[model samples]
Target chain A: MRNLSSRLSRWLISGPPLLYLLIFFAAPTLIMVFAAFRIPGDYGGLLPLLQTDDAGKTEVLINAGNWHDFITFENFGRFFEDSIYAELFLKSFWYAGITTLICIVLAYPLAWLIARSNKKTRDLLVLLVILPFWSNFLIRVYAWMIILGPQSYFSVALNHLLALVGIEPVSLLFSQFAVIIGLVYVHLPFMVLPLYANLEKHDMALLDAAQDLGANAWQRFWRITWPLSLPGVWAGTALVFIPALGMFAIPDLLGGTNSIMIGNLIKQQFLDSRDWPFGSVLSIMLTLSVLLMAAIAGWAGRSKKERA
Target chain B: MALLEIRDVVKTFGDFTAVNHVSLSVEAGEFFTLLGPSGCGKTTLLRMLAGFEQPNAGQILLDGKDMSQVPPEKRPVHTVFQSYALFPHMTVAQNIAFPLQMAGVAKADIPARVDEVLEDVRLQQFAKRLPHELSGGQRQRVAIARALVNRPRLLLLDEPLSALDAKLREEMQLELINLQKEVGITFVYVTHDQGEALALSHRIAVMNKGEVAQLDAPETIYSYPKNRFVADFIGQCNLLDAKVAEVGGSRMKLEIPGVGLCEALPVEGAQVGQSGTLTLRPEKIRLAAAVTHDADEVHFKGKVHDCLYLGDVTIYIVELENGTLVETMLPNSAPGRARFFDDNDAVELAWRFDAGHFLLG
Candidate 1:
């Protein structure tokens, strides 16, 4: 009786969260997945395949034929054959990969500086990294537009400087490079926070011991600091890459017509072409790819811990 | 020439002085200890020798070369840190081979060298295990082996055995002594535990507030401390305020207010009527039922205030007439356990004339 009561109490504590997830997240996800398989009606709704007659009235109902049609891979086939989805997928991955690499290159030294700084300077740097989040993200993207635009202060000053050097004025706004810069700027904090957390917890005495054991600065970093900080690097890379993969606003605001990423393609399928089934298929594929990335990262972290 | 010469080294952290004008010379194969309490700057001095922290005012010469401009990696010294700072990602053998690999030894010879070090520390069976997988004592052994593998001329150990339990600490202290003898390398050891310093070191420099209070062998430090701090720090000592009644060469008679006259070996700067402290070790005093008149021994009459039986020794707190307390330790060498004197028992204590050391400062 006591054991049963204890188990009952434990379930009581955990029951609400489980029910909330089922209602809010799992239910909606199930509906979207079911919709992905079904045939679309005239206005992006599921087709009613059942009919009923009661008294003198006839009513539409779910049909078994619609369920059979829903199970077929026709929408998936149309998505792959009609659209340049493979190219978009590769380009999205390429952009995200480059952005993640750049974030790491920039974030590592920044995190190290903050981690090794005195109390006041460390707090200031950390605050600077987080301060961008207080402002609206869309506004921040617009600010980048002004800074990179042709008639802006930066372009004006650069054109003047170029005239002195006998070079032509250049355009930087509405390019792939601009999108990358926007992505790196917005997602930099995500990479810096995790890396700083890991680096801050490191014992400085280890470095001294390594140096005392005849490792110079370069060897000390490669042998001791780099290997030890790998978990942080991997974590930061994942944090930046996952969001950068399907980012829409940055590419829409800064990228030109040639720079349409996978996210814009998905958005257009749903809103522009009203192809709900194709959009759902694309969404499912992206979700699966993200899950794969997470699984790989988890495996890498686990093996590293086991080896340690 | 000494293997290591520290000449008037001074280290200041901002406004506070950590090591102030410290100077010493360590012989090539001597196990010299810098013994003091925490914040006394012994570790700071050791760090200066290791070239981790530079002294602002002086130079550290290793093998007659000034090490002020040298980085830690360039210096021929290794340190066993207090935390045992073993690389968590590396196995025992890999950690031991780190120094050798950095020194550019041939890759083929690294394994054999690591094996030799593992054998020396008796961790050969567990060389493949990571640092976290080993016990505390095992980790400490790996740390020692890692340093010794370098075969540096000087090894600096900063309170290496402090993390171990009492029994393990005692065991490791003896092991370290033996290891030092076998390797025949100068070890600049730093610790706050006076007993550990006395047991393991060939010479101890007892530091007090960034200054060396006394530097001598363990026996001399115990029997003849140079000042009140050295006397009080090393072991349990009873210090009585006294005025020098008469001084003749090295011996002097002191008039202690509560205990009356006591004979002590006054330091060289002792003068007549000079106010000083007389230090008497607890174990040197003997207790008896009645006063046994001996020409060489000074006797005192007191009543026992407390008696503590600690298996191998019994400590008695004896109170003099003016309520001054004196502690006397009697070893329990007898086969059977018995209490010698109970509370409030009248007793007489006696010690040799030369047993007390009179500190002028």
Candidate 2:
């Protein structure tokens, strides 16, 4: 009897949080799946269709055609056949890849400097890096829009400078370059923070020991410092790459209508077109891409551990 | 000519001085140790010699060259840190071969040199293991091999055996002594352990605060310390406050309160009525059943307070008449013959006139 009460108490303690997740998160996802196949009625809610037996007795009915009627492959077939969608997907991948590379190159020296600097200087630099996040992310991205807009302060200044060299004013606003720049600026802190956290804990004596053994500056860094800090590099790469892939606001505001990424397509399907089924399919595909990237990262980590 | 010379070297961190105006010259192929307690600046002085730290006001000459401006990496000297500072990512052989590889030595020569150093340090079989995989003694050997592989003119060790257990520390001390003998390189070792310093070093420089208290051979430093600090630091010594009563040829009569006048060696420039301390080693004071010898000048009657029976010797803590405690070591013989002195047993303490040295301060 006592054992039963203990088991009941344990169940009661854990039941509320699990039930909350199931109702608020899991239930909505399940309902979305069900609603994707439901037949449309006069209103948005699905209504039951009636059927009569051979005796002609009236009875409440459930229609199986609600699940089977929408057999048209129009959405999936269109997404695959259209070259625009394919191009957008490929462009998103390349943009995220380039942003990740730039973040790695830039954040490495920044993180190293922060890790090796004196305490007061390091704290000040870290504060400056994170100060942008104090305001709303959307507001920060919008600030970039003002800087790159035509006839804006930067554009006017650059145009005057170029006119002196007998050149035309460069159009940088609403371009893919603007979107890439916005992504790099917004995600740089994410890359630097993790890299600094890992690099700060490195044993600096290892470098000194290497130098004592006749290793010059370059040899010491390549053979000792870099290999010891590989984990931080991998962590920084993942932190920058994953979020840049799904970035929506920066591309929309900076790239304007020309830069339509996968995130923009998903947003348009759900809100603009009101096609929840296709939106759900696209959402699932984006999630799968993230999962695949995570799996590859995990594999790389495992191999590194094995080699060590 | 000396292999290393540090002339009037002083290091200051802001207003606080770490190494004062100190000067010393070390001969080639000599094992010299800097012996001091923590914060005494022995390590700081060693670092200056290694070119890791530059003195604020001094000059360091290495092999007749002024090396005060040279950096640690460009210098021909290496240091073995107390932590071993072994590269965690490199194997034992690779760790030792790093210096040679950095010098752009031939790839074929690197392996053989590594093997030679490993064999010299008796760690040839564990060449492929990482530092963390080896025992503390083995890791220490690897660190030594790594430093010696570079063929440096001078090797500096900063309390290298401080991180080991007692047994391992002893074994490593002997090994280090032998290694120094074999290599014939100038060794500047830093440690706080007096026994380690005495055993391994040809000469020792005892440091106090930011200055060298005394620098001499091991026996001279132990037998004839220059001051109260050296006398108290080197070994257990009884320091009695006294004043000079009379001065003779090489001896002086000191009048100690609560104890009668005693004869002690007259230190240089000591005069009558000068305040000083009479320093006597514990082993130098003899305990007997009665005053058997007429030549014994300073004698005291005391009662034994405690007795400890060690394997080879027994120590008796005798409480003198003036309520001061004195310890005397007696060798153990066949059972009761050596056990005559016990707690509360009365005994007489006496020493020769030359056993006690007078310290001015």
Candidate 3:
């Protein structure tokens, strides 16, 4: 009797949350996957045709002929057949890759400074890095919009300097550079936090030892510091890259018409084009690629551990 | 000329003085140890030698060249840190080759030199393994090998054996001595363990409060410590407060409170009727129930206050007539050997007249 009560208590603690996930998350994902394999309705809805059973009773059943259409890979076939989707996919990867690179370049020196600072200074710097999270992310992005706008103070001053140099006045917003700047600005802390945590635990005495053994500052950094902090580098890269790939708001707010990424294309398919099956197909592809990236990262981390 | 001359070096961090006006000269090919307790600034001196730290005043001369402006990499020095500080990502061979690589040894020549040093440390079989894969002793050898690989003029060891277990520390102590001799590099070692210092050093500078309290050969430092700090820090010692009764040639007679008139070596500036202290090592004093009279020895009567049976030796805490406590060590020789003196046993202890070194109070 006690065993039954204990089991009931365990279930009571976990069962509701698990059931909620099943209904809210798993159910929608399962439906979306099933819908990806079917043809869209005339009005872009996913209502399967109802049918009656041979038993003298009416039943709500999916049309079996739709399976034949799914087997033909109609949605996937159309997605691959379109070159614009392929171009958008590549463009998304390029933007995400460049953003991750820029974030790494900017975060490393800042993270090193934080790690090397005294305790009080370190706490204040880390707080400054995290202070932005207290403000609304969308509002922060909008703020960047004003700062980078063509007629804004920064751009106007930049244009004056260009005019002094006899160069053309450059438009700072609604460009690829603006999109990259937005992505880097948003994702920098994601990179810095992990790198700082890793570098903070680094044995500084190793640098001293290296120096005593005839290593210059640059050699010590390249040989001792950089290689040891690879795990954090990879972690920060994933944190920046995965989200940047599917980011919609930053590109929509700052990028030009030429900057339409896979995320924008997918949004257009589901809403404007009313192509539910194609949107589901793109979402599945994105999810698979992310899982693959995570798997590769895990393997790299494991290999590094084995080598160490 | 000495290989390294540290002339009146001082280091201060804010208001705290870490190494204060310390000066020493280390000869080439000597195993010199800076022996002290923790926070005694021995490691700071060693760090300054390695050029990791700069003295606020005074200068360090390596091979008669002033190293004030030279950075650690350019200086002809290397250090083995207490933590070993071997690169965790590098293999044992790679760790050993680090110094050579930093010195710009050619890639083709690196592996052979690494192998040679690895063999010197007797870690040839573990070359492919990472530092985390090795044992404590093995990692220590790797650190040592890494430091020695470049053939630096001086090798500074900052309490490298402090991390090892007792047995491993002893074994590494002997290995380090042999390695120092083989390399023939002037070594500046720092350690809190007095036994490690005595076992390894040709000469020891006993540091106290950021200054060298006494610097001498191990035997001289052990036998005739210049001050109470060195005597107490080096080993088990019994200090007895005494008043000088008379001063003769090379010796003085002291009136010890517990033992009455005792003859001691006259330290410089010891005058008659002035109060002083006598330092006697526990091992130097012999205890017996009855003893033959010797002119060269001084004897005192006491009772055994406590007897401790440590495996190799038995310690007897003897209470002298005037209530001064003196500890004496008697060798056990063999296991289960009976002790001569037990608790409350009346005994007479004698030591050589020169055994009691006089120190100013």
Top TM-score prediction, candidate number:
3
lDDT of 3 by residue, B91-157 (tens): 9988888888888899999999999888889999999999999999999999999999989899889
Sort the candidates on lDDT, descending order: 1, 3, 2
Poorest lDDT segment (10 consecutive residues) of candidate 1 chain A: A44-53
Off by over 4 Å in 2: A1-87, A116-127, A216-220, A256-258, A273-285, A294-308, B243-258, B261-275, B294-298, B305-315, B322-324, B331-344
Candidate 1: stretches off by over 4 Å: A1-6, A45-71, A118-121, A160-168, A297-308, B243-272, B291-293
Is model 2 an incorrect, acceptable, medium or high docking prediction? medium
Ranking by TM-score: 3, 1, 2
lDDT of 3 by residue, A1-308 (tens): 99999999999999999999999999998988877877777788664556466886675554575457433478888888988777788889999999999999999999999999999999999999999999998999999999999879999999999999999999999899999999999999999999999999999888988888888889999999999999899889988999999998888899988886778878888998888888999988887878887898789879976875
Q: RMSD of each candidate?
A: 2.9, 4.6, 3.1
Please name the candidate that would achieve the greatest DockQ relative to the true structure: 3
lDDT of each: 0.89, 0.84, 0.89
| Ranking of all candidate structures by their DockQ, best first | 3, 1, 2
DockQ of each: 0.79, 0.54, 0.83
lDDT of 3 at B6: 88
Model 3: how far residue A308 lies from native, Å: 9.3
Predicted candidate 1 versus true structure: per-residue lDDT over B1-361, tens digit per residue:
9999989889999998999888989999999999999999999998888888889998889999999998999888999999999999899999999999989999999999999989888899999999999999999999999999979999999999999999999999999999999989899999999999999999999998998889999999999888889999999999878898998865678887877887776568678888988889999898978868687788889999998888889999999877889989888887775688899999999999888888774
Q: Model 2 misses residue A60 by how many Å?
A: 13
